[model samples]
Target: MGVVNVTPDSFSDGGRWFEPEAAVEHGLRLLAEGADLLDVGGESTRPGAHRVSPDEERRRVLPVVADLVAAGAVVSVDTTRAAVAAEAVEAGAHVVNDVSGGLADPEMYRTVARTGAVYVAMHWRGPSDVMDGLARYDDVVAQVRDELAARVAEALGAGVAPEQLVLDPGLGFAKQGADNWPLLAHLDALTGLGRPVLVGASRKRFLGHLLADRDGVPAPPEGRDRATAAVSALAAAAGAWCVRVHDVPGSADAVRVAAAWRAARDVTTHGETSGAHHA
Candidate 1:
């Protein structure tokens, strides 16, 4: 997956693609660069970011989605609003990647079910504005596991098919630097929810913080490609179905390497005849 932020204030590559034409061009470029799916978001969901109204979000995202769909791109709308999700689905978005996991809007689940689009329920506690302070947790892994499980139930209750849903751990949302690492360490727990897991840690603040020096200077988002690819390899090795990333070519290569390594390991440790353990 590749990320296309259509907001002027996204934490990374914000104003760069705020215009519909620019966003469409960027989406096409990513597709050419080996992105299996293009994720377009109208609003910025970074910590302390303000919300965009449904109408504004629609205006920011739909035109780009329409163009991408017309050009044969598999598009996913990154939104937390029901109205925006409905509109994007109608305009040819195949998936709804809601960062808020239906917590921000009561109508999100119903609207997703009505559209029958693949729904990605991400772990989130509240709006982005004050989420930094909400990062407190005694056991980050257990809390995230329990919260995502409940979201799966909520999505099912809203009439979405079990196979049509995907789970995301929301890498940086409401998670402190310390909490984020432990969550990544236990990604299989989220995958154990019986649905595919999507990991989106590319160009995020937490990854940059982890790679910082003793001077506490953070690596710029653009310069974090190597670190992002390292975690991309980790996520794929852990059986993540998809990884949302900005550097599509690098991530695609990492996943391929990880897949090959797992294949080779299975053949050696599980024996060639043990199909049960090959996955």
Candidate 2:
């Protein structure tokens, strides 16, 4: 999955694709770079970001979603509002990638259920402005897994089909830099919930901090793409359903390599088993 932030304040590439035409062109470029799908978000979910009005979000998002869909790309509207998700689906979006899971809006699950579009329920603690304070977790991975399971339950209870659901371990939403590492390390715990897992670790602060300078200054978001690509390779190898990324080509190549490596590993394992049986 490729990220298309249609907001003026996104932490990565803010305002670069804020216009509908630029956003659509960027989405098409990402598709050409091998993005399987595009995740278009209007609101900036970066830390300390404020909310945009529903009308403004719709205005910024709908045209881009419509144009991209017309161009034959599978698009996911990255939003928390039920109205936005519903309208984006109506405008031809195939997925509703809600970072707030179903916690942000009472109407979200019902709306998604009614639309029959794929729903990505990310594990979120709260809104972006206050989310940093909510990073208190006993065991980040287990907690995130359990919380995501609860969101899945909420989605199912709201009449959303199980297969229509996808899970994301909301990386930077409420997580401290250290919190993200365990979640990435224990992705199996998230995937163990019997849902397709979407890993959106692209150019996040955690990766920047991990690759910080000798003076301890964190790397800028754009500088984290290589690290992000490494995470993509590992996540894909660990059974991630998809990896959301800013630099589509790097991660695109990383995942393909991971897939080939996995295939070879499976072939080797099968051959070993056959030789053991013959012996």
Candidate 3:
């Protein structure tokens, strides 16, 4: 999955694609660069970022989505508003990547069900502005699993097919630097819930902190792609169904390498175990 932030304030690559034409171009470029899925988000969900009205979000993404889909790209609209989602689906988005996990809007689930588009139910505690305050978890991984389980249940009850949903732990949404690492390290915990997991750890602040400079200053967003690609490789190896990223080609290569390594390891381990049993 490749990220296309069509907002002016997303933590990274904000103003770069704020224009619909530019966003569509970027989405097409990502597809050419090996992105299997293009995720276009109109709202900025970065910490302390203000909200965009539903109409504004629609204005930002609908045209881009239509243009991309018309260009033969598989597009997912990253939105929390039911209205925006409905329009996006009508405009040719194949998936609705709701970072809100059905929390922000009472109408989202029904809207999603009616559209029958793929639903990405991400783990979210609150709006971006206040989410940082809601990150108190006894065991971050376990809590994320339990909370995500509940969201899954809700989505099922709302008429979304069990298979139509994908779960995302929401790498940096409300998590601190410390919290992000544990979640990534324990990604299988989320994958164990009988659902495909989508890990979006691209160019996030946590990676910057992880790659701190000599003076302890975090690297800028663009500088975090290498670490992000590393995370993508690890997550894919851990069984993530898809990893959202800004630099699609690098992550695309990383996942391929990870898949190949896992296949080889499994073959070797199986052969060794068979030899040991025969001996």
Candidate 4:
């Protein structure tokens, strides 16, 4: 998945694609760069970002989704609003990547069920404006998994088919720097839920903090793509269904490498185990 935020205030590369024409053009460029799917968002969703009206979100995304779909890209509309999702699906979006899972909108699952769009339910405690305070957790990874199970139950209750749903751990949404590492290091727990995991860690503050300078300054957003691609490599090796990234080419390369490495490791381990058993 390649990210294209159509809102002006997203943490990275926001206003750069806020215009419909520019957004669609960028989508095409990412496609050429090896994005299997395009994720277009109208809201910022960065920490402390406020909500935009549903209508405005709709206005920002629908045209871009339509144009990108017309240009032959499989698109996912990154939104929490059922109305926007409904309209976007009607306009040709293949998936709905909701940051709030189904918590933000009562009708989201129903809209997805109605439209038959693939739904990505990200683990979230609240909207971006106050999500930081909601980050408390006894065990972040397990808690996220349990909470995601609840979201899955909610969607299942809302009549969505099991196969239509996917889960995301929402890496930097409500998480502090310390909280993120555990989740990424132990992503298998999330994948063990029997649902595919979608990781969106591209250009996040946590990566920047990890790569902080000697002066203690975090790496800048543009400078963090390599780190993001490294995360993609590990996540794919650990069985992520897909990784949402801004640097599509980097991640595309990383996952391919990780997949090959895993294949070789599996063969080596299986051979060693078989020889020992025969001995």
Candidate 5:
């Protein structure tokens, strides 16, 4: 998956694609660079970011979603608003990537259920502005897995089919820098919940901090692409279903390497089993 932030403050390439035409062009570029799908979001969910009005979000997202889908690109609307998700689906979006799970909008699950579009429910504690305060977790991995499970249950109760659901471990949303590492390390716990896991660790602060300078200054977002690509390779090897990223080419290549490596490992394991049987 490729990211298309149609907001003016997404912490990454914000205003770069804020215009519909630019966003559509970027989406095409990402597709050409091997993005399986595009995740188009209007609101800036970065830490301390303010919320945009529902009308404003719709205005920002709908046209981009419509144009991209019309251009034969598979699109997911990265929104917490039910109205926006419904409209984007109406505009031909294939998925609803809700960072807030179902907490932000009461009607989101129903809208997804009604539309029959794929729903990606990310584990989130609160809104972006106050979420940093809610990052306390006794066991981050266990808590995240359990919380995601609860959200999955809620989505199921709201009429979303189990098979249409995907899970994301909302990296950096309410997490401290250290919190993200364990989640990435224990992705099997999330995938163990019987849903495909979508990992969105692209150019996030945690990666920047990990690759910080000797003076301890974090890397800028654009500078974090290599780290993001590394995470993409690791996550793909660890059974991730998809990795959302801003730089599609690097991650696209990384995942292909991981897939080939996995194939070789599987083949080797099968050969060993056959040798043991013949012996």
Candidate 6:
């Protein structure tokens, strides 16, 4: 997956693709860079970021999503509002990538179900402006796992088919640096939810902080693609269903390699099993 922020306040590429034409072009470019799916977000979910209204979010995302889908890209609308999601899907988005799961909107699940689009429910507590205080947990990984499971149940209760749902750990949402680390370390637990796991750790502040501590300082945003790709590769190896990233080509390449290695491992294990049985 590749991220295309169509908002003026996105943490990584804010204001870079806010214009409809420019955002559409960028989504096409990411598709060319081998993004299997394009995620278009109209709102900036960066910590302390102000919320964009559903009307504005729809206005920003619908046109871009329409263009991407028309051009044959699998488009996911990154939104929390049910109203925005319904409009985006009508405009051509095939997936609903809600960072707030369904907590932010009472009707989000029903909206997704009505659209029949794939729904990505990210672990979240509240709006980014106040999410930091919601990170209180004895075991962040387990807590996230449990919360995501409940979300799955909620979606089902809201009439969403089990096959149409995916889970995201929401790496930076309401999570402190320490919280983010443990979640990644136990990403398999999230995957064990019996749903596809989508992890977004690209250019996140916690990663920059981690690098700063390790190297005595950290590089700027431009220098974080490599780190993001590294994390992408790790997520792929851990069996992530998809990794939301900005560096599409690098992360796609990493996923391909990880997939090949996993295939090889499976083949070898099967061979060993056959040989042992014969012996």
Better of 3 and 5 by lDDT: 5
Candidate 2 C-alpha lDDT tens digits along 1-279 = 999999998899968999999999999999999999999999999999999999999999999999999999999999999999999999999999999999999999999999999999999999999999999988998889999999999889999999999999999879999999889999999989999999999999999999999999999999999999999999999999999999999999999999999998877877798999999
Instruction: Score candidate 3 by TM-score against the native.
Output: 0.96
- Candidate 4: tens digits of C-alpha lDDT, residues 226-272: 99999999999999999999989999999999999999887787679
Off by over 4 Å in 3: 269-279
Clashing pairs for predicted structure model 2, backbone only: none
Q: Per-residue alpha-carbon lDDT of model 1 for 1-279, expressed as tens digits?
A: 999999999777758989999999999999998899899998998889998887898889999999999999999999998989999999999999999999988999999988999999999998899999899899999999999999999889988889889999999999988888888889988888899999999999987887788899988888788888989999999999999998888998999999999998876744545765675
> TM-score: which is higher, 2 or 3?
2
TM agreement with the true structure for every prediction? 0.95, 0.97, 0.96, 0.96, 0.97, 0.94
C-alpha lDDT of residue 211 in model 3: 86
Off by over 4 Å in 4: 268-279
Which pairs in model 4 have colliding backbones? none
Better of 3 and 4 by lDDT: 4
List, residue by residue over 1-279, the lDDT tens digit for candidate 3. 999989988788758989888898888899999999899998899899889887888888888999999999899999999999999899898999999999989899989889999999999999999989987877999999999999999988989888889999998888887898899899889989999999999988888988889999999999999888999999999999999999988899999999999998877876798999999
| Model 3 alpha-carbon miss at residue 127, Å | 0.6
How many clashes show up per model?
0, 0, 0, 0, 0, 0
**lDDT for 46 (candidate 4):** 87
Residues 22-96, candidate 6: write the lDDT tens digits.
998998999899999999998888899998777888888888899889999999999999988988888888899
Q: What does the lDDT read for residue 47 in candidate 3?
A: 92
RMSD of 1: 3.2
